[model samples]
Target: MTVSGKTRHRFRCRYTSMPSPTSSLSSSYRNPGGSVSSSSLYHHASYLRRGKLVLGIMDFKWTLVFVITLLNLQPSSANGNGTVERKVHVGFIVDTQSWMGKIVDSCISMALSDLYLRNNHYRTKLVVHTRDFHGDPFLVLSQALSLLQSVELDALIVAESSGGVKILAGLGSRVKIPIISLFAAAPSLSFSQHPYWIRIGEDESSQAKGIATIVEEFRWRSVIFIYEDNDSAREFLPDLITSFEETDTRIALHIALLTSSTDGDIIDQLKKLMDLHTSVYVVHTSPILASRLFLNAKWLGMIGKEYAWITTSMITNFVNSMDPSVIEAMQGVVRFKPYVPSSKAVRRFEIRWSKNIDGNQNLQEIELNVCMVYGPMI
Candidate 1:
């Protein structure tokens, strides 16, 4: 049958009303497993509603379908005029075995998808190639060099932990490609020194102020600082001490834990802290280390209302995505997280992501930040 949008057509046949056929049409469109095409189903339903079709409502629905089909058939603007769209290759250096690495991977995929879906007019598309560095500086440098030599990358997104930032930043400068970091928030990697590096994660120094505010608001006179023994954590310690000092707060103790620290080391450190009278603690470390500390603290019966545990945003941002048992261990802990404005788009994306992308995991703030930074650039 021919489909036309003639405005003044009428039919003499009567069979049924429009609602039943419209519902059937919708069902058929939703589940199109049957041999009948949507167009045929619509026409048959319209004919069944009335022995002969009328022009008004039926024609309008058909016109809408046709328009949607036409839109779907239209080629992308970037591919017009027989011109090939340039593919911008971007490399990602991450610790694939780690939790932050997974978040970074998911966020990068979502960002690229959103960019193309929203801006179909762009003349370039990003192609991401990922390399895992296992959070080792030497491995990170080797990976960066390999990626630069093997691929014509336009940019590099490094999602390593704190210690590897400088090595990756140096590689970015030597290669003359911008290095974008979504998770590395070391204060030492300054823009003046590493002009090619861009960090999107909230600076630990700024978040230290938030921590100090929480301490002052709670009227805590002194707190024990527990942080990773790395450049990133050390870089923020001075600022945190300064912030606390500004608010008339004192650091009762400072303990640095190495990544290679064993359970005995953690427990021993906790024993030392417990020997003191300090009940207030501020932890600034990677989630892995934070998890270990909290788990050991919970085992030692140190996590309770009497002891106030505060964590920096580095730990807070990914708290929701952490293992539930680990979250339970730090039940009453106060966390300092950067404020992010609520967006319906982000909410919808999160829901979709939880349902389809990673069913077991919730979207984290760092993942959202990564998407926000990379989405616009694409």
Candidate 2:
């Protein structure tokens, strides 16, 4: 029994807070024959060992024969017995050229269908809407809105960089549906005008709070924030610096306004910072920039127990994915924003998606973060 198509009403789950994708499943049933109580099964779903998804099996009985058949079938969206198709539509409007943009897009594309199918018990026809914020974001967003306004979408998931907030602001009153915003750092999001808009990514304020936590936890006496000269950086850094200042934290601020600077100059300025004996040096930039600094630190033999370096979570995962040698030097030295998945649900989703998607079994570092905010499978 799979529910297909968008219901006029959102099915607000009885249990709706964020769940650990890796949490242990607490219950299961043992019905010998075909029939089982739908009430019990629906309320307490059976998941695989480590919260991995059990694909194609909604709240229903599966005989041993059918189970084996499903297990043997090549995993994909279509295919497998006991699977009911439910198409979900989602749209992401964001800049695709940047590293973060590319990552967000890839994460959503790879994980959405498989995750939604397993978690929500429905197959999804994911429709992503994207736009680059390079030129006039207003124009790009307006175009996106025009396309989406008429489409009979299940749900609209919009993603935008910092610059795309105005677009979100403009669309707040015009579009009348559940809108989930990704990577949105709009000042207005805190208010009621955009009630439908829910932000899931680590905003600058959250990033700052995370930094302040690390600073206080480690008892790093003093800190210096090194940032690029850009509107986003400038806007966020001051608040971050202010948050750390509450403890009367010793802070030094340095600006690297590089419209076009050679790698040597970049490294040279970092080398000078290395000479400062700052307890912890923070870089509020993208992964590319963070990696450069990490590499420079490694080259200068500046990475060690003596100097603790930290940055926002945006760069931490990328740092971990770098070359082993590069990773080794900075291992345990960097930390990213932390959000644990429902261990029980995650294990269930993995198993389910694995069978559905034909055994593409590697699940480490896959992004289901979008799934967290935009509950729609698509």
The whole-model lDDT of each prediction reads: 0.63, 0.49
- Which of the numbered candidates is closest to the native, going by highest TM-score? 1
- Model 1 stretches with alpha carbons more than 4 Å out: 1-81, 321-324, 359-378
What does each candidate score in C-alpha RMSD? 21.3, 16.5
Output the worst ten-in-a-row residue range by lDDT, candidate 2.
8-17
Residue 230 error, candidate 2, Å: 4.1
lDDT string for model 1 (1-378, tens) is 111122232211111112343333221211113232334433542333221222211233443353234334433434557865666677888886776676667666776787779888865656788899876767887888899889878778787656777788887788787787765356566778888876655445555655665456446678899999987788888888877887867998899999888889999999888889777888889888998899999999787544667777667767766777887787656565444334797677666556545444444323343223332332
The TM-scores of all predictions, comma-separated, are: 0.71, 0.60
